[model samples]
Target: MDGQEGKATRKGPGAPRRNWRLYGVTAVGLAVVCGVAAAVGQVVRAGEASAVEAPKYAVGSGGGTKLDLPVRPTVPVTLTVYEDPRSPQSRAFAQRYAATFSHLLASGQLQINYRLVTQSDKQYGGSGAKEAAAAAACAEDQGRFAQFMDQVWQHQPAPANDALKDRNLLTGLAKKAGKINHDAFTLCVDRGQRNGWVAQSQSEFAAAGLGEAPVVQINGRPLPVPPAQLTPAELTSLVSDEAQRVATAATP
Candidate 1:
């Protein structure tokens, strides 16, 4: 169903499961930074350099962009999320959890790995989901993915409108994101540099056999209740309980 209301559509079939492994509940060292698209020159990380023509984001053994607060210390939880920019549910989920996300991230109790899904592109007959996801990846290059996505939801057209492929609209939103390199953003969006990365993300989503968009997993498992149906307090309790459990296990 991919969590789009009013329609029952199956996800794509027979996609290869990108190699997926579960991270233990132990403290995470650091979040993965997404590599720049080929259009941009090589990026050096910690004195190591690699060249790949395609846009490469830090992905899990499964899939998703690993995002976390820069100031956070070692923590015991990671939230694995799947979303489609074009999906109304995904937007609502983002809005609904914005504060909770801040609290969790600041507390160093959680980090998020976001997987952008494009199932709606197949069901709704447009490339908006894929394009938007790629564009967001481009924003990731500038360390503005979260801000760029906020603009995306704020300006998202109707599902059937299929307006995301418009470079003007996308570039305009990049401008709204503040401090982003307007020329680079426009070039990345226009050239579809991250399209391959977006496609691989979607493939990994499908291969997991997940049924819908707006999926939230705690420590590699879905919440006991559907994320949309959960209150912030409930979510906090859930994460707190897990953190406590992990602490208990680590006690000498």
Candidate 2:
């Protein structure tokens, strides 16, 4: 279409075009099935896995040096998300039910873990996904991992693989988070300092033999839901019910 058409097309000549807002709104329902899929061809090519010595350390996954909320329930229920920043399913899930996770985190009822997977680089043919993972880890070091991640998902780049690979935009997001020191965050990202840690985190996820991104696990077991069909209320109810269940079980 011509510029006078008053439209911004993500596609070029001869490519099928669609409305960006409608596409984004409709794409909000994408979901990834939770399971250890047997597809094992993908690998993290960014950096070598270094040792993680923190008693509780991870990027967004609970515990360690990662991005974990301060939820200290005794005998806590765990929610680990093996996710990728560029995964459409993860974006969709965030678009719809991120508030539910936020509510759960506030209640301190579950130990949430975000295990990042950069295999989308292999699946999508670029290093953007992998670099995004590292950038997120840098945010973790700056104490904005949780806030920064919510913002990332909330305002993810369109066409996940390509636009999100920009290093400047990724670091700029940290600056936008406000809590993170922009200088440190910038240096961390620019120097690719956390790439090794990000690689190690992804390595752990791969070694666990998990499937694709947006893999949800509760108590170290897969928790599958039809992301397209799930409602926020239902998810919050599920969290409440799980909290009660854990409390009851721990009483004995």
Candidate 3:
């Protein structure tokens, strides 16, 4: 009789132990389902965020100049200037003022647009330089003008008396920017199809009496004085003051 009671106790415990294994399997399955659901939700959220941010970087979305100036004003004024990528003065100005200008643009205080001009001609052996400007214009067609300008200014070669025209080098730079249609750009630049536009910009500059490099115009008027070498702080102050002046002038 004691042996039968012991056997009965062992069988009752074994039944509940088997039930616990089934419960453990169900718990693990539910955990896997929840984890997969959470991962999918995160992916959807990321996609939505990307969608919202893409339009901010879209080129030519805002109208102002051919360069597509930002619509909102952080400062009360806009500065339009002509810049030659190969000019030493232009290069220095870009390096010095880039940071301040970028900050002001970020704050919506100022807008800047650049018109490119070529100083190199056949007599000066500027065929290569001319090609670069045309290639830059072609890149403009593809909405890569700002990037190409940045690269050209950063890597300009020194002016030598008789260097071979580097059409190849300029084309290589454009290709690196994903503008691989060199033939098209070369043709466009060679035929001077865009000369009318270039002439118009030149006319605007001349009418404004801007002869020298680094000419700055504030609210369609030339700066009362041009700085010999503009520092970042000076540029910041200049832009800030001009912005306030323009805002005041606009009021009745």
Candidate 4:
């Protein structure tokens, strides 16, 4: 997937397979980042030239003049995450915070939906990465997107590595996630039908000026800087504050 901007092509064999050791490295990184997201509200500032529009979700809230996600005070907030399977940062975020998000979901505090992007391969050299995106989409057909995403994030390989694209790995992860039929998952990956969804997500990311992984949007607006970078405590506070805002707004 490696090519210069505007001259990229999606053609090549997948990268080498990763050993189990890589998983350990990713796990450690996720732990550290999770702690950061929990203790500090750290987010990378958008580049001055990032060209991202004021996200649709931020158009009306007094905080930034953006409309908030139309969430009912009694219902959990739904967060949509744009991610790339080949990106380590995305994996780390998923590993560290997905469970917390799940807790909020169960408690009616938050909900989440994920959109997988496959554009990195064109810049990073993991041509097969798109395959992973397709596989996850296929898993979604079986109502297994959440399970598939958890596996992908838990076992995400380094960028430019094709290990994440292996059919066996995808199937193994799906099986581990308890997909009802490994054969169905395998068939889906082999057929490559879901690549369109990946392409659409990539297009959306590009239009949004999100050139990397782990782009998070609360409701429809991008999270402010501190929370964007997964600063633990800061993110927690922000979520709490936003939740309160949503709740108060709902009161008579």
Candidate 5:
């Protein structure tokens, strides 16, 4: 059943695929901004005049109203990760490598753009994935995207079919992110403020020619991982080495 964004336990290379047509959510506009999101208009890349909306998960100091990539230039690596919340592989990888990623994030050695693929909802025959994705988008609105992600992956529902549509579960996950304003975050989740964007993210991901979730690209190039090592510690090492490699290559 490891088809398209599912666990790679029983699939040949590239056998898995996303049935985007069935997902039925429209993708949002693409923005390559530096920081997260906010309730009002957000800060964009300096001197940028486009009306492009702020990225939902922009990292910044002012509760996501501002978009600033943390840390600095010793290592410049951009990691564009496309993931589906219901995908076992995606959850495994995120939690398995959380420490390493957090370190890189803190050091400003890595620039990360998380692309969500809610199409797993259709592929897996449930709305759990899509709803969880919308919850994630709500978390981003509260400037706690990364934090909420960790909790969701850490406490991932078992059985693959267990729905993530439980409001109580989602709220608990959001609280782990920080001192969140529960009322606002809850309302955002209930209303799905970023549902359209959630849909559009998958569309943009496909448009970029990345065929599936749990896909990682470094500097716009695919960062290949053998299916065998999907959960090995070596996965994190590879990412670390790639960050260094990109930094070294950019050096004068």
Candidate 6:
């Protein structure tokens, strides 16, 4: 997560390879899940979760980012995740917490805002990061950001491979996501409508001084621990703590 020095606001240093150890949460510590049991229709890794009739969230666009909001508003703790699609660390973080995040969204307790960046393209020497990000943006337009994101990361190539630079591969992966309109996605990729937005978003990421990919924030604050060291139960605790703080502040 080291930041590259002497870089302009448009790009930053690429994230280094790091081993994101998945810490296991003990059964006793998992008691916190009880608070949001209603959202846990069945606990399963998000990568393996079946495609549903609809998205888990009401996907939308704003501020050069994709927004995933709960079906109904509740305390509203927003998780703003800045990610470079080509970064393996970002992939690890996303997949590791997918199911926990799914439950949080289902319980109407959290909102997720995904900010896509392409620093990895500069680091890895290809347009894959940009291409993948814009494709996700197009998916957002079609209300399939969640599904596209899951499939994209699950199918991410090696950090140096840059396979996503091929439009056919990108479009093919979209098709595999199901529910997404292949024709619209293909047209979006050809037109590159979201490319500029992707660039603008990268600029914002640079300006924000965010050091690396998978930079996660809760209610506008950085996570207490690095995303790699964070476990699902710890994330749940953090979100619930934020919810309580918001609730307390509003108590009259």
Better of 1 and 4 by lDDT: 1
Compared with the true structure, what per-residue lDDT tens digits does model 2 show for residues 78-158?
887777887778878766767688788787776688888887777878777778888888898877887777767866766
Number of the predicted model whose lDDT against the real structure is largest: 6
Query: All models: lDDT?
Result: 0.82, 0.72, 0.68, 0.73, 0.73, 0.85
The window of 10 residues in a row where model 4 has the poorest summed lDDT is 8-17
Query: Candidate 1 lDDT (Cα, whole model)?
Result: 0.82
> 1-252 in candidate 6: lDDT tens per residue?
234434543243332212212223444446667646734644544535753434555566664333575554558799999988899999998889899999998977899999999999989898999999999999999898888888888899998999988898888888878888888888998999999999999999989898989999999999999888889999999999999898888789
Q: In model 6, how large is the Cα lDDT of residue 167?
A: 92
The TM-score that candidate 4 achieves is 0.65
List, in order, the clash count of every candidate structure.
1, 11, 5, 19, 9, 0
Question: Model 1: per-residue lDDT, tens digit, 1-252?
Answer: 447632333323312222222232121322222223322334435234543333343333444444432443344888898999998889989988889999998898888899899998887888989988999999999999999999998998988888987778888888898889988888888888999999999999899898789899999998999987999899989988988877787788
- State model 2's lDDT: 0.72
What are the per-residue Cα lDDT tens digits for candidate 3 across 50-152?
7633344345535532434355554467877666555666667776777777897887778887777545333355544445566677778778887776777
CA deviation > 4 Å runs, candidate 2 = 1-75, 224-229
Candidate ranking under lDDT, highest first, comes to 6, 1, 4, 5, 2, 3
What's the true lDDT of residue 40 in model 6? 61
TM-score of 1: 0.70
Candidate 5 vs. truth: CA RMSD? 34.8
Clashing residue pairs in candidate 6 are none
In candidate 3, list every pair of residues with a backbone clash: 73-108, 74-108, 74-109, 75-108, 75-109
**Model 2 lowest lDDT segment of ten:** 32-41
Clashes of 3: 5
Residue 56, model 3: Cα distance from true site in angstroms:
29
Ranking by TM-score: 6, 1, 4, 2, 5, 3
